[model samples]
Each structure stands twice: as structure tokens, then as C-alpha cells.
Target: MAIELAGRPHRVPEGSSLADLLAALGHAPQACATALNGDFVRREQRHATRLAEGDRVVLVQPIVGG
Candidate 1:
């Protein structure tokens, strides 16, 4: 299946979850914020958030500033 990952088209195995995609991409779940289809997804929900084809996934890094 293919999904829009960070604005680019990315292919992933069927039944891949947000957590699975993160691991496959070498990203730590705790290192960034996750969103599916423009809606924010909590850390604990990643494992249960099944990804569907063409789903929009966005990963945002933390901004540290004062």
C-alpha cells in the first residue's frame, strides 16, 4: 500500500501501523509528533492506529526555543 508520508508518496506493507512505519523509517516514536490525515495521534494510539492506503502521515520535530 502507498501513503503520503511527510508529503511524499511512500509504499508500506499492508496492515502497517503508525508505529510500524516509524520503526521502518528509523524514527523513534518519542522523537517526534505524529499525525494521521491531518489529525494528531497520541503515542499510545500508534500501535492501534492502522494505516490505510493513501493516508496522509505527517511527522513534526520538536522546536526548542525561548
Candidate 2:
């Protein structure tokens, strides 16, 4: 399956979930926030956040702005 990560395209394994995608990108679920096709995906949803063939996965770093 292929997903858009930060505006770029990434080809990932089929049936991959948000958690799986994060791991593949060297990111920890606890350290980032995500949105799938404009829908905010909470931490608890990671496991159920399956990536479709053309799904878009947008990951953002935790906000720490002063």
C-alpha cells in the first residue's frame, strides 16, 4: 500500500496500521500526533488505523512552542 507522508509518497506493506507505519518511519506512537486523510487519529486508534491503498498519513511532532 502507498500513503502520503508529509506531502511525499511512501510505499508500505499491505494491511499496515498506523502503529506499523510509525515503526517503519522510526517514530514512537507516544511521541507524535497523526491525521489520516484529514481525520485525527488518536493514540488508542493507532492499532485500528489501517492504511488503505491510497490513504494519506500525516504525522506531526508534539507541540512544544513557547
Q: Per-candidate TM vs. native?
A: 0.93, 0.90
> Model 1, residue 50: displacement in angstroms?
0.5
Tens digit per residue, CA lDDT, model 1, 1-66: 999999999999999999999999999889999999999999999999999999999999898999
Candidate that scores best on TM-score: 1
- Could you tell me the TM-score of candidate 2? 0.90
RMSD of each: 1.0, 1.2
Report the number of the highest-lDDT candidate. 1
Instruction: Tell me the tens digit of each residue's lDDT in model 2 across 1-66.
Output: 777888898999999999999998899779999999998999998989889988888898977889
Report the C-alpha displacement of residue 31, candidate 2, in angstroms: 0.7
